[model samples]
Target: MRKFLLPLLFILLFIAESLFVQFLPGDFFGGNRILAPRFLFSALLLLTIFVGRKKGIIYAAIFGLIFDIVYIEIIGIYLFLFPFVAYVISKIMHVLQANIIVAYFVSILGIALLEIGVYEMDYLIHVTNLDFLDFLNLRLYPTLILNAAFLLIFIYPLKRYFEKYAEALRDE
Candidate 1:
């Protein structure tokens, strides 16, 4: 149970993201802005911070592949990007203090990296016709706002849970 708990939480977050999107009104913000929920991504960064990087990268890869299959259907994009983002965040986290505030900012960076990465790929592949400026304004900003607000609300619980679990791992 202990070993599976974190991954279970991540799976729940992944599912919740879809539900969150579904619950939103179709005409949100006059239907101009797209609010992409990156709940799992943010939590993955937090996991990297509080837990070990190896575990983080592993989970990122697995969930990312699952995410790609279930949601993106882009095959290798997220499968490649998720572990890459986790690796980069793990490197950045090496020198930073592990705290909720730092996690917030670090998560912002991860979110930006993932967003741009996916957008650029989609654009290059002709999957998205959105111009860069329009993409930034209409998609990125709203997504950042939505995910940041989510982090602000749930980061504390996430921090506490991951920190305690990490401490347990350390003691083992």
Candidate 2:
């Protein structure tokens, strides 16, 4: 039951991404800004910090593959990116304190990494026509804002949950 909660929460976040886009007002000033939900990646970063890198990477791989299969035609993009981001966050956690304030910034870092990695990959494959400046203006800003809000709202509960879960696992 405890184990299932983590994956179930991720599944909810994954589904919520599309729902978020659907509910947001369709048009914005400044030529229709884009807000891609990277909430799961934020959770993954929290998972790495409060849980452990091993569990974090495992969940990342599972959820990443699901994300690719359901949300993308490209099969390997998130499949590769998720665990990669989690690994990087694990290393970063070694250098920085994992308190709420720093963790919030770290969540932002995770979102930024995921966003830039996607932009770069898409640019390389010619999937996106938006240039660097357009990417910054249209996608990065909105996406960061959206995911930042998510982290702000959920960070404490998530941190506490992960810490409790980790403690339980250690006891077993």
TM per candidate comes to: 0.96, 0.95
lDDT of 1 by residue, 123-171 (tens): 9999999999999999998889989999999999999999999998999
For candidate 2, what is the lDDT? 0.87
Candidate 2 similarity to native, TM-score: 0.95
Q: For model 2, how does the per-residue alpha-carbon lDDT over 1-172 read when each residue is reduced to its tens digit? A: 7878988998888878878878877675345888888877888889988888999999999888998998888999998998999899889989988899998998798888888998999999999989999899899998898888889899999999988999999999
Clash pairs, model 1 backbone: none
**Worst 10 contiguous positions by lDDT, candidate 1:** 26-35
Which regions of candidate 2 are displaced past 4 Å?
28-31
Sequence-dependent TM-score of model 1: 0.96
User: Considering only N, C-alpha and C atoms within 3 Å, which residue pairs clash in candidate 2?
Assistant: none
